[model samples]
Target: MKLETIDQVAVIGSGTMGSQIAMVCAIAGYRVVLNDIEESSLEKAKESLEGHMERWIKKERLTEQQVAEAFGRIVYSTFLNDLKDSDLVIEAVVEKLDVKRDIFEKLDQLLPEHAILATNSSTIVSSKIADATFRPVKVCNIHFFNPALVMELVEVVQGPHTSDETAQTAFQFVESIGKLPVLLKKEISGFVANRILGKLMDEALFLYENGYASHEEIDLVVTKALKHPIGPFALMDLTGLDVNYYVRQQRYEESGNEADRPAKTVEEKVNKGELGRKTGKGFYSYT
Candidate 1:
């Protein structure tokens, strides 16, 4: 298959990653359609996108006019049926194989034969979702970091059946959008960054479980001494304890190990809706 320039990009799921990915595509001059299942979700996504753009203007990273133009290139829709015109559809929904496969199967029916299908799944294997699509050759992973615009690296993971040309097109397009693309030849559990991050978190959880130190003390030691941006507990809070647990659980299920399990404290807190800084609570209090 010949590599085609992505003219219309659809970001399925208007959550944080999806909205940010849509914003980046718009800023890079691609027409972006953000698809979600709820009007409220679209509203939240639009607010999130506008807030980020306002920050750019406030910080002088973008002229007001430029921000306006960028915003103009994006639209929001609640219908999956509207994805018929997309040149590329990226699924950034929750990291669940069943949900992702369902979306991919629907997208395979929606898009044309030449259109590309990608997922923003951070942990699940590309092949798992690929098998659910009729056009498995076009299915690949374009995993962007948390904040898509600021972060340069995008993990371009190709499934076994993914065509080389299709994978290359995805990589080049990601680079065109001002991102550094890392190509993984085959599927690996947790890809790369998540694996490294998970191992570190596991050790930290083990230490805390053993009463090696208090949360605040451990955080202080890591941040002040190791010069990390923040300690593990603080980072977990920022990521939302629930979100972190989901990622860890994905790895644990794949590896079939108890060690990869999410910390009990994290899971209990998440179950109680005591998420993180966004909620003004977590390992530490924001107020």
Candidate 2:
């Protein structure tokens, strides 16, 4: 189907990335269905979207009328069957292969034949989940950066079974929503950004663990010397330590490499339920 044919979009999970993605589609004038099994999470998504709209209005990035219209276009639902008419379904659920595969299988059975299935996973590739559905040609990875409403760069990854037309259509869809789209020629574990980020994080952890410097010092050096926007530890806190831990665990499970395991500090934080900004504590205290 052509990009113009996509009128209804659905985002599953309603978490940080999912909710922001739904709002982004809504602002772009598409009917959006933001789905989550829990009503509390859906309420949180609605509150987050309202806060984003209010901030944009105050900054003059969006008018009050535009925000109102966008809000009106979004529908919250707990039923996966509600996505039956969605022209595009983006899965932003937990970063687990089995869970993602199950969701894809269900979505494939529910959505129209022409509906495109996309995953917003940072590490898991579409190839790993595409086989779970019969419409492998319609499945591809459309990885959006964290804070989806603000981040401009999106990676559209083509799996082994994904059709060329599907990748092109997904790329066009990303552009249609006012985001920069980069094509991944082949499917890889972390796509592009996360792979590079993984290396940086590994080195940063090594430095802190080996007594080269404290995390704070390392972050200061990266920010002041390299002119990076945020230090590695601070970024981890924003992204969630629990998320980093799970991604690393998945990588280790896939490769069976000890080096791919999560850092000790990350594990420690997750064990304590510090889980970064969401929990108000991680490498740094948000409170």
TM-scores, each model vs. reference:
0.94, 0.98
Runs in model 2 lying further than 4 Å from the true structure: none
The per-residue C-alpha lDDT of model 1 at residue 109 equals: 86
- List, residue by residue over 195-277, the lDDT tens digit for candidate 2: 99889999999999999999999999999999989999999998888889989998999999999999998998899999989
Give the Å shift of residue 114 in candidate 2: 0.4
Which window of 10 residues has the lowest lDDT sum in candidate 2?
A: 237-246
Model 1 stretches astray by more than 4 angstroms: 1-4
lDDT of 1: 0.85
> In candidate 1, what are the lDDT values of residues 115-170, reduced to their tens digit?
99998887887788887878888888899987687889999998898899888999
Which residue pairs clash within candidate 1?
A: none
Which candidate achieves the best lDDT against the true structure?
Answer: 2
